[model samples]
Every structure is written in C-alpha cells, then in structure tokens.
Target: MNPLHRNKFVAAIVAVISLTACSTPDAAGEPASTTRRVTNAEHELVFHVLEGKSPALVLDAGGGLSSSYWKDLAPRLAKATGSKVITYDRAGEGESDEVSGPWRVENAVSDLEAGLRELGVTDDVVLVSHSIAGEVATTFVNEHPGRVSGAVLVDANVPDFFTDEMLTAFAPVVEKQKADLLAQPSTKKNRQLLAVMADYAPVHRVFHRRAWPKDVPVTAIVASQTPFTDSPEAAGLWRAAQERFAQARPNRKHVLAENTSHEGIVTERPDVVTGAVEDILKIVR
Candidate 1:
C-alpha cells in the first residue's frame, strides 16, 4: 500500500491497530505515583501504581499506546474515585522487555495476572480498557470472573463487531501493512507492530466467537465518530456491536460520547470515561 492508501486504511481501523507511537505525552507527564518494574519469566514490565483502596482499577491502553496515554487521567481517577489505579506497558511497548512473537490477548492477560499478583491486588479489580485492550479485558474477565467486580470499555473493539464480513473488510489493509513491515529491518517497534498485525484478523475472528461473561456488570462507551470516519458501513457495524454488547445482559449500560472520536475519547473526553468508571465503582461497591 502506498502512503496515502495506508493512511486512509489506518484511520478506518485506528481502534484495532496503532502502528505509530501514541500522541500522548511521554513518561515525564506521568502522575506522582509508585513506579516499579515487575518481572515475569525473565521479562520486565514497568507498572505504575497510585496507592488507594480496593477494588483496584487497572487501566490498559489501546494498541500502539503506552501507559503514558493515561498520565493525565490516572491521578484524576485515583483522586475522584479513591480506588487504586494501576497502569503498565505491555511487552514490547514502553520500557517492558521485548519478546519475539505476535501479540496475543492471552499473553497480555498473563502479564496482567502477574502484575496484579505481585502487587497483591488479587481481587475486586475494575478493568478500564480502551480500544483493542478491550479484548484483553474480555478474556481476563472471562478467565477470572471471580476477581473482576466491574468493567468500563471505552470506545473499545468488542467481539460482536468483528463479523465475517468485517474481518474481510479489514484484511486488505492488514495484509498490506504486515507485508510492508516484514520487508523492513526489525526494530522493536516494527517487530511489535508486525507481530500485532500478523494476528489481527485471527484474533478478532476468535474474539467474535467469544462472549463476555454475563454475570459481570459493564459499561460500553461508544465514540461518536468511531474509528471509521471514512467508511460509514464499518462505523455502523461498530456502533451496533457496542449496542449488542450492552443490551445482551442486565446491569450493562451503553453511553455515547457525542462529538468524540475513538482516539479523542481518552484525551478529550476523560470526563465521560471517568464518569462511567465512577458509576461502575458504585455498583461493584
């Protein structure tokens, strides 16, 4: 794909793949919190913790983003909700150890489980996941339904959205990007990006077959413009997916972040995101 085509395709699926580094400020903007490097199986993951009380709130960034995306919002959330806020860099992102392989939700979950155990935050977790981290939150909740009390999915990519047709729509761009990345010299960022794109379709295919545990309460926040400003059909499918997720069970609510785009929800619409988390905290408490 040429530069122009790639840009358009990327904008269409911005929520699923983030090739460039997040536009959020660097670690210098991170809140005054306890930061530590947690190791698992010879790999090191950097986690930032803001002390508070349970249930602990774990913030997982979207694809291609580091914990820095939460810098401005973490401290505010910690203060407003009085719940422990935890954020970390996934393997190959930020200061975490880089491993050679495709990015899988299961591995992400393992890293999370390790971090939570190391920090002694084993229960009452309120997972706050954005964009593709939604998959991590979904798998984690299902795998450990007993631990998570509530969840907030912000402009996330829910399983219901990745239908056969949608996956087909995503293939051309994903394949072109993967091929392009494969031809380049392997840097940490390129490797991570390629690995993630390599399995993007397959992961979503699996995600589409899975469902969120009905017992857990959830809040699905949908962005106004979504991630498909260039494709109306895809945008419609995205909104419908969130609606299905919200209405599938009791204690699930769907909120529309009017005038917000997928990427802007975390930066420009922290109030909406924060409010949703506060509401979930109330129910879980």
Candidate 2:
C-alpha cells in the first residue's frame, strides 16, 4: 500500500475493527497537555497529561491507533472542561512498552489502572473511549467502579460485541481489515495489538456483560455510521442496545453524533463530544 493509501486504509479499518470489536477544540494556539512517560514495570507508557482543576478525563484509543489519535481533540477538551485530559499509547501501539500479552480487556484495564496510579491520579476519572475501547473502559469501570466517576462511550463497542450473531456478522469485517492491514508492512507491530484484541474479544464480551458497572453516569454517543450496525437489522439492534445501555442505570444518556462517521466522532466532533462530557460532569458533580 502506498503511504497515502495505507493512511486511508488505516482509517477505514479503524472503524470496522472495533465492532469486529465500537475530541476537542483548543485555544492559546498550542496544546494544553504536557507529555511525559510513565512506567508500568518494564513497559514505558508515554502520556500527554493536561493539568486542570476538574476531575481527570482519560482518552483510550481504538485498536491499531496510537495516542496520537487524540492529537486534535485532547487539548481542546482540556480547555473546554477545565480538566486534565490524559492520552497515551497502549503497549506496542506507540511509545508504550511492547509488553507481550493477550489483548484481554482486563489487561487493558489493568494497564490504565497502573498507569493512573503511577501518575498519582487517585481521584475518580471520566473515561472517554472510542471504538473497541468501549470494552476496555467498560471493563475498568466494572473492576474499579470507585475509580471512574463517569464515562463517554463515543461510537464505542458494546459490552456484548461477541454475541454469537454479532461475531458471525463481525467476522467478515475483521477478516477484510486484517487482510488490508497485512499489506502495510509498517503497521505489522501495530497488528500485534490487534492480535491480542482478537484473541480476547469474545472473552471480553462475556466478562463485561456479567459485571458492567451501574453506579456511575454513562453517556453513549453513537456515530451515524458503524460497521457493526450498517444494515436495517444491525442498525435496529445497535440502537436498541445503545438505548438499553443508557437505561441500564440511573443518570445514563444516549446521543447521536449527527453526520459523524466512526472516526469523526473522535477526530472531528470534539465539540459535540465535549458538550456531552460537560453535561455528564454537570450531572455527576
């Protein structure tokens, strides 16, 4: 794949893989966040942490993307919400330790927990997750409910993504993404992250469902387009699930990122997402 095509193709599959698996404006003319690296034992995770007064806002990337995925939005979100916006690359994805392990949602969750601790961020945080990271954020909320004050699921993967029907539906998308990705040699290491995600996805579905946190406020934001819910039946099922998730606990809300694509919800619709984040914080606070 040409560099241009590789970039384009990378964008395309980022949307497809999350179901197979599921930003901001800034001011001051510079990024508000400061970059630093933290160690979770052998792995060195690079983070961009914005210092502010409000509860922390942690950004989780979709599979195959680095923390750079939030480059356009985090600083703006930090300014908008008057909160710290923390973004980092996962193991083997960017500067983070290429720690070898299955991409179990639990491991992702653990990494965040450890990383947060290393940052001395004991205060509860609002997890902002895009794409399949819905699984990771959702699992973290489950394992450490007290640590998460809220969550924003931006076109995020549902907890039950691996239902028999969904997996059957999701396989083709995943396979095609895998094939396209294989042609991009520069991305081979990134695919290692994908490999673990694939191995643990079904297990994550089961784990998240049985223990999804119900105490904190959650906002489910859906992009208008998603590989997981493209057709009539799939769309209906997706909407119903998103709604039910919102209704699952008190103070949950669902919004559509009108005219937004899966990636755009994070990269382009920072204003919309930040609005949702502001609203969620207002209610929870």
Candidate 3:
C-alpha cells in the first residue's frame, strides 16, 4: 500500500479507539453521574435530583416507608410546576442509613432540613408529603415557616381522625408490635434506634391538635378506602379531620378519589395527587 493511504488508515483506527474510551456505560451498569449520594445528619442518603426551570419541590415518604412512595407522583408535580424535584429515603428505610432511630416527627423534620441543606435547596420549595408524613410536613411548616412555600398532604394521618376509643384500641396493638420488634435480634438495631426517635402516641396526639399553618398553601387529598378504621365512627372521624384541615388553612382545598386506598393516592393514583398538587402550585405561582 502507498505510505499516505497506510497513514490515513492508522489515524482512522486511533480516532475510533478514542471515541470508545470516552463512551459511558448504559443503564445496565452504574447509574448516571447525575444521581449521587449525600449525607444528612445521621444517615447517608441516596437521591435523584431532576432539574427544571421553576421552583423546587421536596418529597417526604410515609412511616416505615421510603421515598419510593413518591416515585410516581413527584415527577408529575415537577412537570406541572416546571421546577426541579428532590426525593430521598429517610434513615432506616430504603437505601438510607439505619444508624439513626426512634423516627419521631421532629427527627423526620430534622432529616429533611439536613437533606435540603446538603442538596443546596436554598430556594423556596414546595413540600409534598404522603400518609403519616403529613405530620412531619405540618410540624416543619409550623416550626420553620420560612423554608416552605406550599404543602400537599395526601391521605395524611391527623389526630382528630382517631377517637378516644380508637386510640385506646390501637394502643395495645402498637405496643405489642413495638415489643415484638425490640425482641427480635435481627431487628434490634433498628428498633433500639427507632425507639429513641419514634413516638407514635405523641405523634397521634399532636396530629389531632396540630393546626394547619395559615401562611402556607395547603391541600389535602383523601383516599376513598379507609385502611386503618373499620368502624362507622372511625370513618366519620377521618372525614371530620379532612374537613377541619381544609377549613383551617385560608388557601386549603380537599379532593377525594374513588377506588383509591391510602397508599394509592400517591402510588396508584398519581394523576389524582398530581392534579391537586398542580392546583396548589397555581395558587403559589
């Protein structure tokens, strides 16, 4: 072959090799660099930050659950609001550390504050909480009113929703579970840590009496199927709590979805929850 042709062939081969070296692995391998780990107060948290042009939204999961609960709903809200969205598991749940325990409402709030700081979420953010997380969101708004711009509570557990008799009936069951969890050797670490931060009774009582912050735009979405209570009185109590929540806030609103369970409001019925969240965003915007 001519010397010029041979030289051109060698150069082409070298270019191909360079391109291959720069190529990144696909979905099967390590995740994209955009998804990274951040450390909160007492836990190493893994999170996904989806960037956008508008305000930010932070998602908080329910009791004993992780941020995966907001898997379906958060992205939808991000799209509707045209803003970035942050979702992460609390300590002891999902991929986060199990080092911290007791998981009290206040601890949950602290974890959230630490997470937002780590993620550099300094701008005004909308907090979207699900199930038992409603208590955390409300408490945080009440305590740190300046941080949050709006809140969306989906099938939140409120105190007034439980009658005195209902609380009495569940007290023994909760204690039994707490005991059994502590007795198990495998779960001892989580239980001990959880016992320190967890206070279900106080959480219940607080929710019953906790008032919605007048400054924040709050929206509550009630699920059609009531999972915790079987009695007619309990059902009525749940309805009353939702009514009170809607009435308490100046910009509060409530919506009920048909055939959706407590968990389904954020998971199965993303459209329903997203619709309500979009409404709240409209008011805030």
Q: Which regions in candidate 1 have their CA more than 4 angstroms from the true location?
A: 1-11, 14-32, 184-187
lDDT of 2 by residue, 78-155 (tens): 778778788888777777767665566666777788878877787679889887788788778777858889889887
Q: How much lDDT does each candidate structure score?
A: 0.82, 0.70, 0.64
Estimate, for each residue in 1-285, the C-alpha lDDT of model 3 and write its tens digit: 343433333222111110001222334322221354667564676666666654577787665567777766666666666677778776666777776445566776787777777667865888888766777787888778788888788777655564555555455445655566567776634453345324555655655677766778888888887543334444566678788868765688888877787655566688887787678778776
lDDT of 3 at 120: 77
Ranking by TM-score: 1, 2, 3
Candidate 2: where is the Cα deviation over 4 Å?
A: 1-32, 168-186, 228-233
Q: Which parts of model 3 have CA positions greater than 4 angstroms off? A: 1-33, 162-169, 182-198
lDDT of 1 by residue, 1-285 (tens): 345544565545643655112223335534346777788767888888887788999999887789998989998898898888999998888888887777788888999899888888999999999888898999998888699999999888788988887667657777876777779997876777777776677777898898898888999999898787766666677888899999999889999988898877888889999999999998989
Ranking by lDDT: 1, 2, 3
**Pairs in steric clash, model 1:** none
Q: Can you give the lDDT of residue 70 in candidate 1?
A: 95
Give the true-structure RMSD of model 2: 7.0
